[model samples]
Target: MTKIVVDPITRIEGHLRIEAEVAGGRVTDAWSSSTMFRGIETILKGRDPRDAWYVTQRFCGVCTTVHSIASIRAVENALKIAIPSNAELIRNIIIGIQNVQDHVIHFYHLHALDWVDITSGLTADPAKTAALAASISDWPLNSPTYFKEVQDKVKAFVAKGRLGPFANAYWGHPAYKLPPEANLMATAHYLEALEWQKDVIKIHAILGSKNPHPQTFLVGGMAIPIDPDSQNALNADKLAEIKRLLTKAGEFVEKVYIPDLLAVASFYKEWAGIGGGVGNFLSFGEFPQQGGGQPWLPAGVVLNRDLGKALPVDHRKVTEYVDHSWYEYSGGAGKGLHPWEGESEGKYSGPKPPFQHLDTSGKYSWVKAPRYEDQPMEVGPLARLLVAYAAGHKPVQDAVNGVLGKLSVGPEALFSTLGRTAARGIDCLLIAREMPKWNDQLMDNIGKGDYAIHNGEKWDPDRWPAEASGYGMHEAPRGALGHWIRIRDQKILNYQAVVPSTWNASPRDAKGVRGPYEAALIGTPLADPGKPLEILRIIHSFDPCLACAVHLLDARGNETLKVAVR
Candidate 1:
């Protein structure tokens, strides 16, 4: 057996690394060591719980709104505060818009090249590509002339030795299965998506006061006020503008993104049998209904890949283990602690710097293993749709069944790597359609002269219990994101954020159970050991964000371990 290491597996900004043991051109065992510490939870200690939403947003630049939402919700959950219907609508619109945007970005820019051969796209006939694009969707840009223009631009970039984002890829790898024409079509949309995403995120700027990290999140409710006549708040003009932008975003998802996903997936159907890891799924359901009941998406768990029985989620069953991680729990190394009792003390015992292998025999990674009912489960778009579908959510059922019919595959196919990718597209389509409805709801609330954006009933800390603990959850673009907090004396006592990547990218636990990333790679067939693009397809499908995984940690000013992949 030979060990292959892929350090910083991300396309641009990377923090996760996978070292696989390959035998007979297939992965046998894997160890995923990823580290990027923000120490945000530690910083929140003694700080005002209400202010955590702002500080936690800095956990990662791309995950700005996710952390902020989770933090505020945790504080509110502890205080038993209910936000107004207006605030709920506004938050839903922002989150839905971001989810739609993030999914599109993942497919076109981040995960596409793994399936599309950029060099092959240059060889495609523009006329044939245009025909292919037109057959898939009636997107107006599907013209021979337009495809020709896109081809010429890419040709110029390659001629100048500046491939930009297209650099660093295994251009002609055998694993890329798209035909030149299909590749050309996807490449064209790749450029178009770049322009489309920028415009759609303006929804955030209008209501959020800024993009990346929105400033409107408050513990009790949203900080942005609503008034039909005011220029400084959510007004009639702003509401109209939001609906218009969301409508256009929906069009892009249906016409360009969904069609492209199906096209790419048709060529890789065998993947439905591969990378089916753990066979357990979790979702902290999102897109809540008014009056705060079960979220529209439905929160549930599916164990052993059994879709027939969708289990209800009990937050008390969630626990984290640091057996293979860098931190040490006060109870014992092998002890599993719920987030409220979680600790993040950093202890480095592996080779310091200039080390090759991670010595997997001991604690090797900074990411802790999160388990539900003592079982490691996968989380993200695929998990969300699976749970929702199993729970009899009609819209999700229709969407998943529609995609399964299009692909001519059974529900069992949804367990693979490509299935995970397709689930993202389906999730995007459903939420994209819901964005306009949310905007309309906010508009209706405004028309009724009931523009309450906040519920400050528990804003002051004076009406506090001596001790309280609560957890917040959000079905982020990546997966189930949660923030657990304990408030005492109006200040944060112990805070922990068990982010999506931490759950998906977790290392092995005390019982030697591998996390989703590690398990998914166990049987992946690597076409080439030196250039293991297949392994990447599986890892990127999880959308590993190490910055979010290695969060809530305090290294205590220890010397940063010099990271080396061998």
Candidate 2:
């Protein structure tokens, strides 16, 4: 078996590494690792519980909003404080918009290159690309003239001898199956998405404060005081602006993002059988309705690729193992502890820098293996949709079935890499459609003079129980994100976060069970082991969130790649 290591896997906010063993042109084994150490859990200790949300937002610059929400939810859960109806509606809108924007960015910017060969677009006929784009959707920019201009813009970038965002990829690789026209069409949408994301995320700025860590999150509720008559608060003009932004964002998702996803997926139906790992999925359930009603996306567990029934998820059954991870537990290595009692510390056990393969037999990665009922499970958009579909959610059922019908595949086909990619679009569309309704609901509540956002019932520490503990779960854009906290004397005593990537990108456990990334790669075929584009396809499909991008290293521990950022 020949071993291949991909350190720093993703192009943005990525710090993961994968080591795979190839034999007979297919992967036979794999190990997943994280090159970065996270100390947020330790940093949060002994701090004011109310301010934890602000500090936890630093977990990831890109996923800042989700972390903020998750942290606040944890503190509120611990204090048994329920936010008011207006606060719930506002939070729901922000969460929904965040997921939609992330899904769009993941499809067009991050994962598309694994399928689309941007360099090949230079050889495409702009007119033919226009035809292809028009055939997919009635997006206004489908004119042949617009495509030619887009083609010219790409050609000019290459003329500069640097591809800018399009650099350092395995362009013209054998694994890229899309024709030149499709590649060109996808490239056009990619540029459009860069602009599209910026405009849509203004919802964050208007509602909270700004993007990449909105400042409105609080332990009891949001800091945004809702008052229509007050210009400084959520006034009539700001409300109108929010509604308009969401409406435009929805239009883009429906016309451009969803169309591009479906178009790109058509040529890769075979992927419906590739990279289906662990076959156990988890979702924390997201977008709860006002007044503690059912969440728009209910949480459940699907085991063994079973779509017929979704077992109810009990957060208590969630456990983490550190035997194969870099950290050790007080209970001993390989022991499973739920987040309420979770303990972690930075312990670097891998070989020093400039070293060859990791000591995979022992502790290798910084990511801890999270299990549901002692079983490793995959999380994120696919898991959320699968759980919701199994629970007979009509909208999710219809959206998933619609995609399956368009692709001419059965429900079983949804268990692959391509399906995972497609689920994000389905989830995006559903949430995009629902965002306007949420905005309208908020507006209606404001008209009814319900300006209460914070409950403030248990906001005071003087009324506190000496010790309290609770966990918060949010189905962030990538997957199920959970934060557990223990509060004592109005200060944090213990804190732990088992994020989505921790579940999917974890290494192994005492039983030698591979995490989702490692398991998914076990049977992946590599057309050329030296250039493993197939590996990128599978990993990108997971939508990994780690550190930032960097160059690759050869198996001999040589920095064989050098990339320039514009």
Candidate 3:
């Protein structure tokens, strides 16, 4: 048996340590650990509920808007307040843009390196690359000159021995399957997406008054004023600018992003069967229709690979277990507690860092194991897509069918690493296509003079019931994200955020059942355990945001141990 550890996995949002036991070149056992812990929930105690959104948004820079949305929803749920239709429409549009931007960044920047050999792009003929790009989509940027220019920039960076973002990669790893031209095409898009993301984020700034953390959200509705002539409100010029940006984003998703993903999947079709983790999926549902009606993404569970049997989500059944986590639960180490009554107390009882392997029998991670009905379930784009597909959501069904038809694969193929990756691309296209409708709805509401965006009825503390508790949830870009809050006298008593990563990157529970990340690593064949590029491909499919999963700061900032790998 050989142990392969990828400590502080690169090209991810935060610190994650993945240790897998390999036997005969196949992973037989694995442990996923969040080394650091940031007790954000503990800080929320005694704070005003209205201030929770601002504080929670700091949990993750990458997923700031989702956290902000969930935090407000939790407070709203506690107050039993319903936001206006205009507010809902505006929220959906912002979230839709965020999702598209996130998916694009994940594909080209985070996960693309696992598949595309950047060094090989130097060997690609720009003319052939242009032809390949042109054949796939009608993206106007697919030109020989553009491809050559990107290639030249890459060559210059490589020659300078300063790869920067392109540094420390397994450049010629055998697992890389893309052709030279395809690699060059993807590399070019990788650069293009950086610019594309800036434009997408500008939409967020336009709405929220900032990009990383949008401040426009309020407990009742949005903080943005609505007026046709007012310069400070969401006026005609801002609306037109948003439309223009959305159009550009939509064109990229349809023309560049989706096609590039499909092209990559074609070369790595074998991955369609690998990395099928836990087989259980969950989604909290997002993008509600008018009057707080059913969400576009239905909330449900798909158990044991049975897509035909999607059960409606019972939020009551959700609980977090700290049996194998660093935190101690007040009830007991092995007991499961719902988020409303959740406890987050730090207790690191395991071996310190610089260790070879985690004590999987004991506390191994800072992230608590979250179980649905005590069952380990996977969450993210794959879960959202599967739930939507199972519930017969029309947009999801149409998109899934189109992709499956193009790939000539059955639905079962989606339960793998490749499917997890492809689902994000499919989701982007679906959400991008839906963005214009949301914009139209918001515009119609404004035109009808239904410009009411905030509900000041619940703004006063005296309006509270003295004691209240509620859970706010959103199917974030990552997956099912929820924030549970308990308030008394308008002040937060307890706050727990069961983020998407907690569901996907959790440790073992009382029953010793491995979470989604560990389960997915089992049976994965490692071409070179030392490099472990295969493992990265699987984990990155989840698009982990560990900063949201676990948080801590090493005040000393000392390097304890290092092992050189050749």
Candidate 2 — worst ten consecutive residues by lDDT sum?
Answer: 548-557
**Candidate 1 clashing pairs, residues 3+ apart or interchain:** none
CA displacement after TM-score superposition, residue 45 of candidate 3 (Å): 0.5
So what's the TM-score on candidate 1?
0.97
TM-scores, one per candidate? 0.97, 0.96, 0.97
> Candidate 2 vs candidate 3: which has greater TM-score?
3
Error (Å) of candidate 2 at residue 483 is 0.5
Q: Which residue runs of candidate 2 sit more than 4 Å off their true CA positions?
A: 547-566
Displacement of the residue 496 alpha carbon in candidate 3, Å: 0.5
lDDT of 3: 0.91
381-480, model 1: which lDDT tens digit per residue? 9999999999999999999999999999999999999889999999999999987888888888788888898998877788878788999999999999
Backbone clashes in candidate 3 total 4
Q: Local error of candidate 3 at 150, Å?
A: 1.0
Encode model 3's per-residue lDDT on 379-489: one tens digit a residue: 999899999899888789889989988988888889999899999999999999999899988888888989999888989999899999988999899999999999988
Error of 2 at 453 (Å): 1.6
TM accuracy, model 3: 0.97
In model 1, the runs with Cα more than 4 Å from the true position are 12-14, 551-566
Better of 1 and 3 by lDDT: 3
